[model samples]
Target: MEGGRWDMLEWLGPDASISVFNYLDNPADLARVGAVSKSWRKFVISNQFGKRLCMTLCPEISNFTHIQLWKRYSHQNASPSTSMDWQILERAHIAYTYFAHCFLSCDSDKDCIMTCIGASSTDRFPVESIHNTLVPTDMDHMVYWRSSYWSSAGQADPNVQESLIYHLKRGLYLVNEIRIRPFKAFFQVGDPIYSAKHVRFRMGHSKF
Candidate 1:
């Protein structure tokens, strides 16, 4: 031992130490490990444990080819040719670490939907627009409340279908469960609730 100090990384070797670190799913634990010493911090950043952990939690994150850092963090004077290698690594480390932290600490129970993009078909323009579906429930009244619920255009054939698109809230890095509450038309004569028999969800970045 050098100066009677214990070095776990030295004792375990690179491969074994990496395996041990890989088992840590918690981002906070990894941050603590990096805080242990300079060597530990370098090891964590060099191997990109934060990025790996993020990819493990959300596989879709791997699809990101590049991450745009905030303008405040960017060096105004520094050009691409003049930028130091260590500076780039530092930025990457920060980005991945933040991404992992946000993913791990996210509130899964909270609603992620931000805004209604559009619907495949609406019975009426503003009256039965998809935006009305955002409301939880309608008031107990006989008259139809245009603001309370959304209605799709009636389809004669069973083969015809309708769909909805919504933009999820920003900074919602992980989506655990998506809950859809179908509106029960208490205002209608029969109190019929329109809902799909089988629901399918598609997730991806917007083309726009």
Candidate 2:
């Protein structure tokens, strides 16, 4: 070894060592490699080995997933230090990749890839069932999304506009499209999803 230190991996050169690390599938192992030595850390981050492994693990994440969402959040939270840390950046990248996979990969046609985990609304079916089942999940009843749901109250006198604010528990999502399904009356002979004659939609990124 160069500085009288017994570098166990001294036999393998930088390029070769990276090749070996590239084979690591476990994200924890990659993170631990950084703590092993500064050289190993640099090697792992320089090639973004973690991000590569994440891509292999989640094939559904396309290049159009808008990586800028992650970058924007990362930069907002980043320290003022001059040198950028690719290792940290790669970790965030991998996290967002997995999060995107959770929402984008669907088995059924009605399964919306919307990452909306929770919702708040000006009106709901019943005041008690607000947060229970506003969005579709795999566990929803076979045909119907769920018996539990939300809906706007009376829209008469003033004809107020109804609004439902969906939330993402993970982080800022790079959403291209959002699917909305009107509720169905299960007791009816042919249970059908009722549609609103006209609907309005809006998207935004909020700091609060």
Q: Which candidate number has the best TM-score?
A: 1
lDDT of each: 0.74, 0.55
Instruction: Give candidate 2 misplaced runs (Cα > 4 Å).
Output: 6-10, 62-81, 84-147, 153-162, 170-181, 187-192, 196-208
lDDT of 2 by residue, 84-183 (tens): 5553555555564445354445532333334433334435444324343443433332224344555455456444554555554445444446555566
lDDT of residue 88 for candidate 2: 56
Name the TM-score of candidate 2: 0.55
Which window of ten consecutive residues has the lowest lDDT sum in model 1?
138-147
> What tens digits encode model 1's per-residue C-alpha lDDT throughout 119-205?
888887887688877766535521354456677887988678778889887542446667676656665799887667787877776
lDDT of 1 at 182: 65
- Count of clashing residue pairs in every prediction: 0, 0
